[model samples]
Target: MSQSLLIFAKILSPITSYLNPNTKPPTIAKRYKGKATLKLDIPQGVADLLLKGVINTDTRTYECIVEIIGDEDGSQSDTAKLVVLVAPSTPVCKIAGVAEYGQNINLTCLSEEGTPSPAYKWQSHDVNNVPRPNPPKTTDKNGILSLYNISKDTSGFYICTSTNEIRSAKCFIILAVMQPPMNKVSTCVILAAVAAVIIFGIIIFFYCCRKKNKPEEYEMGRSDEAGGKQLFCCHGIISSSRCAVTPTNNV
Candidate 1:
């Protein structure tokens, strides 16, 4: 008994397609060459479509039909689904909005390819690359990390990870949060003026001390709360498939 086979690629979306069954090996369609082939065992009454190196695009519903050569009305058909799972690819990192003090900014990370639409995570580090906590009102959703009223403390590095059940990939960017230009310029000028005055005073003191044959040195140091750049802690959101850092007393 000889067998004839018919195949169609269709799924929930209903794409009309047909695969030729009139060749010695049961020819696959042109677009399916190399990607698809047929396996037939006449004696065993079996015919199957073999797919190779399937990708995300290959995920769909397929239908197969089998007919006995002499029995025009005797045909069997079956439908099946193919689902492809892919790991997240390396994400592209970006910064939206200005990273200026007291201004809103968003850090966005995107994975160009993934099967299940990867989730995202954002982590912050200090200038020293040491892990740091996010500010009071940081919000991360879908791949957008929103920081409100960024300050100098927000100046550092940020890493974004894209993840799925299959695997994960990551990308990073530097965030140098700055004061507004006008404010920054004014601050610089003021600091310079203060330094000059301090220097002039030191010169006068050294001159007077030199005349008296006495030597003394002055040292200046500065410390700020944000300058400490300590790592922050987090209250993780488990249900949302987000990655969160643990909180520490240092926060």
Candidate 2:
């Protein structure tokens, strides 16, 4: 009596085998016998088919059949499916439309490669550093977050998380709502006015200090027939006169 085995890759490509009765040695298909990764256990009726060193792209179903030669019954067969899971990669996030106040915007998040296509969740941190779900916005199944009538209060740090059955990943971006150009100009003008006031105050302080340190002056009176003179010293407009001694003894 003799027996044979057949293994199919996805039920399409077949690998045939022959079992010799007297030698107890099984012969495998020539095409698959030389493969280093392929292994066969004839006695146990097991075959390990190695697709390749890398399994990223080799996920599919496989089937196998075992039969006894000259038997009235048909061959026994089984099938199995293969699945490869990959963790979610770093997600990419983008904001569509202007981020100004009172405008609509869309935040898109995507993870290009993952096993069991990844789903997304959005989180945000406000100016107060509190974490919560993004408000005034709606997220869809495709991972798009829509913000309607945005405002300064809506600006903060946003995080996009991508997750699947395998694993999860996240990416973040900062949302800054800017004031109008005219408002910025107004702020600049206000700052400039404040600086001018400070400079004027410094100038007035120095002027007052110089005036306080000025030297006092005295006024000299005309000489009289007696050949004596009087001096008037003015201290901030309050003056007093002091008379000089008459010179008559020398004469």
Candidate 3:
């Protein structure tokens, strides 16, 4: 019987190599040391790749190679695919675009981790917690639910489910469509409040800066001896109402 050597490859990189030297069983690469092994008995006519604790990274193409020693035959190889399935992870729900009357928006859901790719489904419920039907002319496909010409009546809670062969996961969000005017008012209010905060912060920053870098006090008003009205300036911290008028009198 002609002796033979076998090699296992993950995209041409050998994980384990069995040589005809007959000195040892098989040499497994350090990276795959404890994770992979070969069946010693080749009499079974098939080389079996035994693996343990397989993970998602193990999903890839695998090739088994055989070479007959000292023969005209060079080497023969067979290829196969290994796919590790993972259950869907918790999905994230999101809303895109403004939620307001007569507006269009999209509700999105996604699972970060899943094998074979997870499919998505959306369910709607009224504010009263009662199940409701998808809006007419609505498009729900590929993890996105599109709502066109939405109104206050379109406000509700939406649930999205991500499913795969391994398992399923779910996430939800509440949509409260408001009137256009109310939405604009709310936005303006938020902007105004933010602007006020920023302005206040700037004033405080300049005040503290000047407090730390106070310059020498020099004459800033006209002398009474010059017959000009001596305008005394009320110097205060930045933003202090007392400093509303800056003295422009000639010194």
Maximum-lDDT candidate: 3
TM-score of 3: 0.70
TM-scores for every candidate against the unseen true structure: 0.60, 0.57, 0.70
Residue-wise lDDT of candidate 1 within 1-251, one digit each (tens)? 34454544454332222323444455556777787766665557566677899999887778766555667787777898888999999999999998888899899999999988999999999999999887788998999999998889888999999999999999999999876789778999999999999999999999877756634322333333675633332231123222343444655
Q: Model 2, residue 152: displacement in angstroms?
A: 1.1
The residue-by-residue lDDT of candidate 2 on 181-213, one tens digit each, is 798779999999999999999999999888787
Off by over 4 Å in 1: 1-5, 11-23, 42-45, 67-76, 183-251
Give, for candidate 3, the lowest lDDT window spanning 10 residues.
236-245
Give the candidates in order of TM-score, highest first: 3, 1, 2
Worst 10 residues of 2 by lDDT: 231-240
Q: Candidate 2 lDDT (Cα, whole model)?
A: 0.71
What order do candidates take by lDDT, descending?
3, 1, 2
Shift of residue 191 alpha carbon in model 2, Å: 32
Selected candidate, larger lDDT, 2 vs 3: 3
lDDT of all the models against the reference?
Answer: 0.75, 0.71, 0.86
lDDT of 2 at 16: 46
